[model samples]
Target chain A: MYMSVAELVDAAKKTKKPIYELVIEQEMDTSHNTREEIWDAMGRNLDIMAAAVKKGAEGEGVFSKTGLTGGEAVKIKNYRSAKKTLSGDLMMQAVQNAVSTNEVNSSMGVICATPTAGSSGTLPGVIFTLKDRLDLTRDQMIQFLFTAGGFGMVLANNAGIAGATGGCQAEVGSASAMGAAAAVELAGGTPEQSAEALAMAISNLLGLVCDPVAGLVELPCVKRNAIGVGNALISADMALAGCTNKIPADEVVAAMDKVGKGLPSTLRETGLGGLAATPTGVRMKEKIFGKAVDAKA
Target chain B: MTVNYKSVFDIIGPIMIGPSSSHTAGACAIGRAANSIFQETPTDIVVHYYESFAQTHKGHGTDYAIISGILGFEPDDSRVPYAIGLARDQGINITFIEEPEDSPINHPNTAIIELTNSKDGKKVTVAGCSIGGGTIEIRGIKMNGFDIKPKGPLPILLVPGSEVDQQNVTDQLTALTKVNEKKQYQSAKGDLFEYDLDRRLKPEEVKELAKNNTNLVYL
Candidate 1:
């Protein structure tokens, strides 16, 4: 169930008519503040377990490592990866590299969202900013979280979040779609608008892949969240504004399935395709993982 | 009536954790967040399961997620259902309302999960949407009938700037009000509760904290 590019583009073009009583909002905290909030909190939360990580590494503790907690975790989440070193934190660093560098890979930025862990950061970066204006109580925020989670849940159940299996469209595409839907709801758009936002957002990033270099979550993944948030917001608003697309949301997901299946295993988070196949990728893996896995047989 | 058709996906098991992370794990996360949000933890719950979740909820472990979430269970908890039972033992009334099947469509994964401590005469209503893969978003909330989505546009940032004429205010709020009528605009040019967050939360300080793998669930 996936919408084609031409269908989405054509429908998106109609959004310019602006029937949604459209309103856009921005809040600043840090660069890509929404995703950063999670990352920063991840960073701060690390402090709680600094002694724990050390203790685990020291053998006093076996496999126990402490981590970020609450808002602090939300804050520095993206940057928690060891930036000073060449070998960045795996999941976060992969995301950062995708957003920061121009290595020219389709594996670049994606919108992370929902239970849609693959695109988790996609909506938070966008919605939290809108949240700043809503004066939402902790309870309200929880509701917003719940609302977003529901759509993500649907995506996960219907489509797969694993890029290796379902592909990038399942991961990032779903996230962006969920993000947009949530944004529309929080923005006071009708449920119809919310659905439209989600469908539009999903159709936009259908058929992306995971395939981070070194089989790590770093690379284009980090910044992808930021861009995804932006796209989610734009497309969501477009959806809410009575802009109808020819391709339905389910069609988009199906298209993603097709694309993901067609992708080479190397491109599906195997660390064999995309940037992971590059010479720098092999070097990085050797430096970090200390293993030489070939890009191909 | 001319019906604008919308595609639908049913019984989607979110891809995050299990059992069905969005239904279970992410529900737990939101449920837990709700527990901590209230001035006091809810001793009762009025739960509404929209669409498919209502039908297959018990099997999906959604009841456990809500109960355990109220008790603040992590997504990976083996004792989640136990926690829900605990809520029952503690006299926390759990009412699950299923939306009429074949209801008008919106976000397929949305639900209205409400919590209340009837004994205390307090209530919290949460409107949430769960995405695939155990992720969640809170769309709105009604606490004692207080609406929470900022009733206006342009999230006011405390970046500190000089006064600007209407032409210079090129913010989303401005653009929204000028064109998008449906947008609720909140004038936040001067609201700075966390002014000079250096005195409050600092970047370096935040960086110092990220070392741990603590999970931060958004409000």
Candidate 2:
């Protein structure tokens, strides 16, 4: 019944419990599942996420039939190792992890959707990066997922989560928000602060469209996940530094829903507008699919 | 309206092989749903892709995913990549149609599957959509105009056609196990009896039910 972000935070605060713990309690009460069972399931998800990250980072990424994505993650990793990037070590690492996961996704590798498969990279990217920086235990990492899940459920229930329904703002935007909130909670910020982080993260990506080149998630989708990682980290840091969102988390989600609805169908994963319709995108499609649409180009 | 998400798994995971959840995993589930609608294994299938699905199915591997599903493969099965070749080897005739832009269906990730049972020459058309995150909704079934959305873990069966005794079938299944929910649709062709059981019925039991009722469809 308590489905709003504010309500979830309030419940957690009232119980003097972490948001993740409250979510655990709620899951137990509703599903009649044992804590061990829930933890085991989450543990499996983490294992898969970890394995995909490792495989992608190691340059063993499988190729999409379109051949648009495969080894970019390894390229990023190689770049990070050779140079000192402007984003610092942790951010660069996060970017590498994010790209790796999304590349794995593009290659048809098994991945856990951190909301949806299109947005899977953001949470794992930020989490793995913070795992080393924060010295988080495996159990704590799982709890971070729960924390993210808690807010994700709220956003999904309130606004939406699918790209086709709400544009990339729904997929990447919601994932980034969920990742930011979990990052805040992991950093020992208050539940309210976590909500602020979520708001900031989502607000930053408002009006973003789901315009993949050639209508494949490989092109801008994989790279956008890399950006989402940095977006989450920055939002988390801002929230930790006492930055506040003027519009609350729930309202921001509602606004995002409205904006997504207002987007043209072409901008919402239809492949008819934005980057998908660009001349280069058309050229790439022609190169991959050939001039099949025309008798002869 | 709230999406019926059973668990956090609904949010974070389906553990699927994918480039796109809406196009791949969910499409596989829709294919599975289409498979379930058949009385026996379908030897022929004609799929009509709609909107975005028609535009980018190849890039997202929607066609492969659906073919794999028709072959009774899950979304994560490695065989999904080679589903077309496998189906060809199995002697299944496959065809595709790009639904016109003015089609009545509105969902971006939608497909209408026409399946033919080789043995009986029975046919069924399933209009389904991949609603993202490996979830699917069977928007309609062409036999008797059934509008069903399968949301449970159990395999749902749709006995379409008026000749079959709907009450008797429901009673038989309800006697064997609790029927979680039941829905019915009356169309010009027949009465569609849809039942959601608490668990999958035993194969032998399903055989008995099918053997007894000629008009029964299992979906």
How many clashing residue pairs appear in each of the predictions shown? Answer: 125, 1
The regions of model 2 sitting more than 4 angstroms off are A29-32, A59-65, A294-297, B143-183, B187-219
Provide all candidates' interface root-mean-square deviations.
15.8, 3.6
Please list the C-alpha lDDT of all candidates, in the order they appear: 0.46, 0.81
Model 1: per-residue Cα lDDT at residue A245: 58
Off by over 4 Å in 1: A1-113, A291-297, B1-219
Choose the strongest candidate by lDDT.
Answer: 2
- What 10-residue stretch in candidate 2 chain B is worst by lDDT? B146-155
DockQ of each: 0.04, 0.43
Taking all chains together, each candidate's TM-score versus the true structure is 0.40, 0.87
lDDT of 2 by residue, A198-283 (tens): 99999999999998887788888998998888999999999999999899988999999899889988887877689878898888
Interface RMSD of 2: 3.6
- List, residue by residue over A165-207, the lDDT tens digit for candidate 1: 5556676676677667766766667655666777778777765
- The candidate that achieves the highest DockQ relative to the unseen native structure: 2
Report the C-alpha displacement of residue B72, candidate 2, in angstroms.
Answer: 2.2
Residue B127, candidate 2: alpha-carbon lDDT: 81
